[model samples]
Target: MSTIIYPAPIFGPVHSRRLGVSLGINLLPGDGKFCTFDCIYCECGYNKDFRPKQKVQTREAVREALEKRLAEMKENGPFPDVLTFAGNGEPTANPYFPEIIEDTLALRDKYFPNAKVSVLSNATLIHNPKVFAALNKVDNNILKLDTVDMDYIRTVDRPTGHYEVENIIEGLKAFKGNLIIQTIFMKGTTEDGKDVDNTSDKYVLPWLEVVKQINPRQVMIYTIDRETPDQKLKKATKEELDRIARLVEEAGIKASASY
Candidate 1:
């Protein structure tokens, strides 16, 4: 199966469907993937399929690369709308992630102060105090919450290590409306022939309840856009995504749907 393995430290001034003109900040190695979760839908593919020989990028390397990229962008054109920490694997998994965030913020201020700094994390490591603090500092702390059901999680998300949805919800609550909740709604069957449609009320309602409890600034509901590792999976229809977005909107929260 085809997959994307992004270069470490910095990449792109690529247009993002959600964030817009995003400058990617990849903390994981360029060669392969390293993540806490092994979601079937991941564009980077399964962890076992693409293992990195190189270690995670260091704090200094991240800072330097980001600075260089920012300088070039400043000198040329296509200024970034957001410096996004999303590529390959989980950004917070990097040992120097917090420090890198600090560096990124400083550089952003020096170059594009108006631009936002965003991190796309799986919400698995928020239990770590340092990771929590770092997330709090960013302009957009976007955390993934596909569903609350453990069965669904195991079937689709398939967390590699210890991951409890209850714990994740609590950690999200601790954010106190500072974070953005990103959810993927899809319709499909896993390779094992088990159904995996999460757009239904069975998944949406319970997930929405937790979203309300978390009280995030916004909820980004999206379907599969690019090619996923799992060929059996299908994108959630625009109508279904809209319905969920409306539910979130009705709850007095801002919601965006990307089909």
Candidate 2:
């Protein structure tokens, strides 16, 4: 199945189960995707044939667009529940992420004071002081951590050369309880037909260790809800997601399954 691609900075005031009515902010260019990790389950599709060159909207342009949208929404009355930083690729990959967040926050305060500022990052940039500071400014800092086992993480997330599992975990540990961890569960037959199931105890155990170390405020567990580039992948059943949530809860962390 072909993935739905929205080529713009502001795509929708779409309904989000976790974030309510979210107004999306796409920092990456509309014509291409730019992210450090090329995950198998990414809704934007795999980054195999794409380059990671950045061509993000300028801070002035994003601010202007957001202000105009907010003003229009205000004139129409009610506003979206959240102004979310999410799009074709990792939002934090934009060099001006911190400035963007600051500008967004200013707009949020001026136009849609009731709405929250949310950022969805892959966690690769968490180690950067600027990125961390920017994330700290947002209301919802949703970071991704699909797995902890190095081999599986490498296969699943396909992170860039600079991103190591240990470094990510180390960065996350500094987050304390200010972070929300997002994990997507799935089962699939690899290109070679080998079954890939991260739900198994072998994978979950090591993953849990990292979760414990990070101690995030909440863990949002969900399965495939949209079309992915890889058709061989199978979505984890609701029952499977619930079981995994239970494991996370038992570890003294809050878990919500959106399967």
Candidate 3:
């Protein structure tokens, strides 16, 4: 299987289609992919494909690297608009996640006070109190919620453990509008030839209702940008995403779509 692993702990002032000019903080190992979900569309590929050469980054290591990058950017180079937590896999999987967030916030305040701190989480760990609290403290707590149907979740996003759709929805609702709900829209055929299409209303309406329930600050809807692990998958059309965005707006929730 073709895959991409982020080979560094601190890299990127890349232009994020959603989060603007962002400096990424990768808390996972530089060599391996560690995540709670093995989603079919994950650009980093499935968790099973990973083989760790480096241990998961520790809090101090992340702090040192981030501070070095920030000081350099602050002193001699361009500044970032946001400090994002995203890399090879789910950043929350890092044991030192909460502390890393603390360090990232302090560095952002010291070097670029105006820069927003964002975390892209899968919502599986939202029930963890420390993770929940840290997410609330960030500027953008982007949580993933692809479909309300459990079967679709299993066939598509593929949560790794004792994941239940109803339970995760309740957990996501705990954020109570303090979060940004990010949904990736796509279509593909399962190994058994079962069709999976989350962009359709049969899926989107129930999901939008859950969005109304969670009542997040905004909903970011986007389609596949990079090559997915599953070659059979296709990105949602811009026209389709636009229609979905309008539905979100009509529900009184702020929405943006990146096609």
Candidate 4:
């Protein structure tokens, strides 16, 4: 199946289920994927399948492109609800990410002060001091934490480099309720017949414990919405998602489920 590949620097003002009318800021190359994790459910497919031919857009270029887009939007009819840092890869992976966030905030203030700046990160680079600081600056510092199980993460999320869930949790706690926890819950079997379901109490309960420890401002629990590279993977049911959300609410934290 064909996968979604976004343009470089900037792409959409597409309607987002969670963020409303959104403008995307793609810091990675437009041609392919450059993420730290090779998730089976990623709409962008695997990293090796789509190696980027072009270099990551420079901070200056991103600023210029965003300014142009915001300018057009300001003159045109539909104003953006949020300026989102998302695309084919991890936005924080860009070398100039911190600088770009600073630029984005300045431009947002200039063009649409009402529009929120959001970043969708895998949470791998949150350990980096610069990335951590930059994320704190954004309106929505959305970080992914699928499960606490390391085997599941390695088999499913497939981190490219060194990744310790304990280390990540420590970094997340540093945010101290300023961040949002985004988790993707899905159920299905992989090509090799291993079960990929993570919506069970085993995963959910453990993940919830971590979320409580991190104590994020909110939790976004979502399922597969688009076609994945691994066709064997399936969407987590609405019932399962809602059940998990209810559990989060019971813990006195806000939760939103997107089925």
TM-score of 3: 0.97
Which portions of model 3 show Cα errors greater than 4 Å? none
Q: What 10-residue stretch in candidate 2 is worst by lDDT? A: 46-55
Clashes of each: 0, 0, 0, 0
In Å, residue 137's CA in model 1 sits off its true spot by: 0.3
Per-residue accuracy of model 2 over 110-167 as CA lDDT, tens digit each: 9888899999888998888999989988999999988887777777788866667888
Which of the two candidates, 1 or 3, achieves a greater TM-score against the reference? 1
What's the TM-score of each model vs. the native? 0.99, 0.94, 0.97, 0.99
How many pairs of residues collide in model 2? 0
Candidate 3 local lDDT, 1-259, one digit each (tens): 5677885688888899998888888888898888889988888987787857788899989999999999999987778999999998889988989988988898888999999999999999989999999999999999999988999888898888899989989998888789999999987776567787788889999898889998999999999898888878888899999999999999999999997
Taking the tens digit of each residue's C-alpha lDDT, what string does model 4 give over 92-120?
A: 99999999999999999999999999999
- In candidate 1, position 97 carries an lDDT of 93
Which model, 3 or 4, shows the larger TM-score?
Answer: 4
Query: Candidate 3: global Cα-lDDT?
Result: 0.89
Model 4, residue 129: distance off in Å is: 0.6
- Model 4: lDDT of residue 156: 95
lDDT of 1 at 167: 91
